[model samples]
Target: MEYEAIIGLETHIQLNTSSKIFCSCKADSWFDGPNTNICPVCTGMPGVLPVLNKAVVEKGALLAAAMNADLQPVSYFDRKNYFYPDLPKGYQISQYDRPLAKGGWLEVPLDGYQRRVGIWKLHLEEDAGKTKNENGQRMIDFNRCGVPLVEMVTGPDLRSADEAAAYLIRLRQLLRWIGVSEADMEKGHLRCDANVSVRLKGSETFNTKTEIKNVNSIEAVRAAINKEIERQVREYERGGKIEAWTLEWDEDTQTLKKMRSKETEADYRYFREPDLLPVHLTEAWKSAILADLPELPLARKARFIGEYGLPEYDADLLTAERSLSDYFESAVKAYGGDPKRVSNWLLNDVMRMLNESGKIAGELSLTPAYLAEIIKLVDAGTVNTNTGKALLDKVNESGKSPAQLVESEGLAKVSDAGAIRAVVEQVIAESPAEVESYRAGKVGLMGWFVGQVMKKLQGKADAQKARELFEELLK
Candidate 1:
């Protein structure tokens, strides 16, 4: 029998607040020395009480609004009783029964259709410290302790590994676009725990599921879920019992190793924390956040397709990053040329440069006005497509405008028919054998003749005009 995989994700996002959730210590402790950012409140010292950061709550509300989640006017923190070397308090402060948001859905594109994945809830919590084991000694850094986090739990609405990956990518884009979190998987700003199960394709009852913890990257999330699904299916087929467990992904081995038994909700022993008061968001405050919400990725993508006349694929790519979409708009506004042409240049030349330089669109030396000029030149046949691309390299290296570089370097299209015909005549005169072959019905040599003329002109010729001149001169 064919089996279908049921996948749910619990994603933890580190908020970008200036201070820790319940303390005034700096929140960005990723690169600091061990425990430098720690204080009495985060380190769980005796008699030190925790206080909520108003900024965290406001950012959480912004995220909820972006996700279309219902923001609960009242929510409170709970003590999730657990013991780990990194957790200084021996219990994490988190939200339990009354989370900050609930009942939202994210729309992801899958198999040429839009699928809405249900968001079970979003709760605020504090991050644990970092634990390092070196040479048989264990070290714990409390710098990350009390760092603000929002855990977004999704329903078991995803069916396959691809769908889960797609949902995650879209979610990250939304988070970044809304400015709530950087959601950079590499830096631990966003992390995922995937719960996966498999049953017969038509069966509705869920099977025993295992949780894959701390799959940091999107590629790893996809691979880990697929591997877990396969393992469960094979075990069930062999008449072996599938038990719920927690596993960790070993990237070097490309395998999942069993960590421990999965913990149920009761295992945490959650209870309301008496130290912190309930967070009550006023309607006026929520309205203010809602009004400040920027255009989300999906909405921007739709607008790109509708207003810019871009294809769905192009719109999807252009709007994948907020900076890239902004760049596209700026170039179009400055050039006032075909938006599709601007998109093609960005998706091809600009993206290639970004990848090679390991820089984001906003960090590139190529300004929007310069890129607009390049597009305008290509559109006006001042330079052919090939010359235009070459100009991008010069602009990046010298920080010169496209027009200045093109003029100084003589990269302009050789559109003068008189000058182009002279090069065509020289090419034909030098290649007598090829011209004879062409006249003898080897018409495919026409392309060869055009290449020779373009080479003679140093790729500065309008290719179409050169090709026409080649045909005329050869006959």
Candidate 2:
């Protein structure tokens, strides 16, 4: 019997706030020295009290609104008891029964169709510190302690690894578009833990699931989940029981290793926090947050298709990132050319350049105005497409305008009929044997003649004009 995998994700997005959740320490912990950003409240010192940062709650509300989540009017913090070297406090302050938001769904594109993934809850919490194990000793850094995070739990609605990865890509794009978090997996700004289980096809009950942790990248997430699914299927085939356990992904070996037994919710012993009061988000506050949300990814994609007449594939690529979509719009508005033409340039040449340079679209030296000008040059036959593409590198190096570089480098298209006629006559006079073969019905030599004329013209002649001149002179 075939088995199907059930998958869910717990994605933790670090909120981009100025201060920690319950303290005033700086939230930028990426480059700070070890234990430099900690304070009495964050370090959990004696006789210290915790205070909630209003900005953290506001950012959470903004994300909740963007996700179409039901924001609870009243939510309280609870103490989640656990012991770890990285956790400065013996218990972490989190939301349990009354989370900040619930019952929302995100639509992810899968296999050329849309699938709705249910969001079980999104709650606010504090981040733990980092624990690094060197040669023999373990060092703890409290710099990330007390950092604000919103843990989004998803329902087990995914059946395949591809679906899971697609869901994460959409989720990260939404988070970045809404301006809540960077959601960069490399920097630890966003982290994920995937829970996977497999059962016989069409089974109503779920088999024992294993939680895979420390999957730092999206590709690793898909790989780890698939490996677990295979392992579970083999165990069940051998008539062995699948036990609940926690596992870690070894990226170097491309395998999963058992970490420990999975802990249940009861093991955490959650209770209401005695230090802080329950949060109450007024109706006016929710309305204001909902009003401030920008257009999300899916909505923008639909609009690109409808307004710009772009194909679904082009629209999807353009709307993948907020900055990239903005860049495309700016170029379209500036150039006033065919939107499809601009889309082609961006999706092909511009994206390739960005990837090769290891820079983002926003960070590249090529601005929207410059790209628009280049597209205009190509459309007007002032420069051929090859010269236009090569001009981008020149523009990046010399910081010159497209028109200026074209003139200085003699890269402009040579549309002068007289000038191209001279080169075509020279090619015919130089190659008597080839010319005789062409006259003797070697029709394929027409392309060879055009190529010779273009080489003589230094790639500055319009290819179509050169071809016409070749055909005329040969006859």
Candidate 3:
């Protein structure tokens, strides 16, 4: 029987709020030493009361709205009972039965097709602490215990490891662009747990899934799913029932090892937290937040086509990153509506420099004003496109005025007809054989004479003028 892999992901993102979810401790302690940034409330000290951070809830709702999820009128926190050294209180305050948002979808673009991934729910939760393996001892830090986190659960809509990886990447991009989360997998700001199962083709039901926890990066997520799928396939071939289990990814071995059996929902014994009251959001508040949403990547892609008259491919490329699109627009505004030239410069010159330097385009200090100034020099015939590119690279590095660079570097194009005439005359005198060949209809030799003039002038002579002057002297 042909088997198909079904995958779903639970992504945990730490919000960028300044304070802990239920305390006043700083939330910027992610990289600090263990137990240093903790306070009485976050560390779960005896007889301390929890106070909710209003900003965390607001940010969570805003994120849910961005995903087009259905926001609940009211939601609150609950206690998730568990025993782990990483968790200080042994009971986490999270949303259980009623999440902040539910039943949404995100559209992921694949090779020549778009796949819709269903979002099961999004819930606000407090983060647990970190465990460190220092030499031979395990150390616990309570600094991150009360940090705000939003866990997004997706439906079993992914059919392959590629699809799952693509979904995670797109989701991370969205979260980062919104300024809600850094979504850095290496830093553990964003973490993913994938539940994967295999089923017969065309079957309505799925087999028991093994939930793989904390597959940090996209590559790890794909590898874990693939290894688990192969393991289950082999078990089926041996006439064994695939059991529901929990596995951890072993990066060195590049395989999934059994951690323990998977726990059901009832195992946590979730109950509503008595300390925190149910939070409510009004419709007017929701509408105001909706209006504050910026143009997302998909919408900006369409706008680039319709408003700027750019090609679909260029539009897609520009809108892939928000900062890049912003930079392109600023350049267009500075250029006064010349979309095509701006697009070429952005797609070719700016991108080439960025790629070569291994830096983001927005990180450069070359503003729209600077780009417009350079393009004007090219349009006015003061410099050819090649010289213009060189000037732009200089400005990119030194942040000097275009005019100043032109004067200091003597990069000004030699537009003097008289000077170019003299150089072309010299070239004709030296390369008489090539000039004779050109007159004999060896048209390719024309380029040879023109190259001589350009070389004589140190490439300062305008190429078009050099070609014209060469032909005149050759005749």
lDDT of each: 0.90, 0.90, 0.85
Q: Output the lDDT of residue 17, model 2.
A: 95
Give per-residue CA lDDT, model 3, range 169-228, as digits (tens): 888878866778888898777899999899878999878888998688899999989888
Question: Candidate 3: lDDT of 324?
Answer: 81
Candidate 1 TM-score, true structure as reference:
0.91
Clash numbers, per candidate:
0, 0, 0
Model 1's alpha-carbon lDDT is 0.90
Model 2: pairs clashing at backbone N, Cα or C within 3 Å: none
- For model 2, residues 117-222, the per-residue Cα lDDT tens digits are 9999799999988999999999999998899999999999999888999998998999888888989998988899999999999999987889999999999999
Candidate 1 Cα outliers beyond 4 Å, as residue runs = 263-269, 431-442
Stretches > 4 Å off in candidate 3: 263-266, 355-360, 398-410, 425-459, 471-475
The C-alpha TM-scores of every prediction are 0.91, 0.91, 0.90
lDDT for predicted candidate 3 compared with the true structure: 0.85
Q: Candidate 1, residues 127-231: lDDT per residue as tens digits?
A: 999998999999888999999999999999999999999998998988888888989998999999999999999998988889998688999999999999999
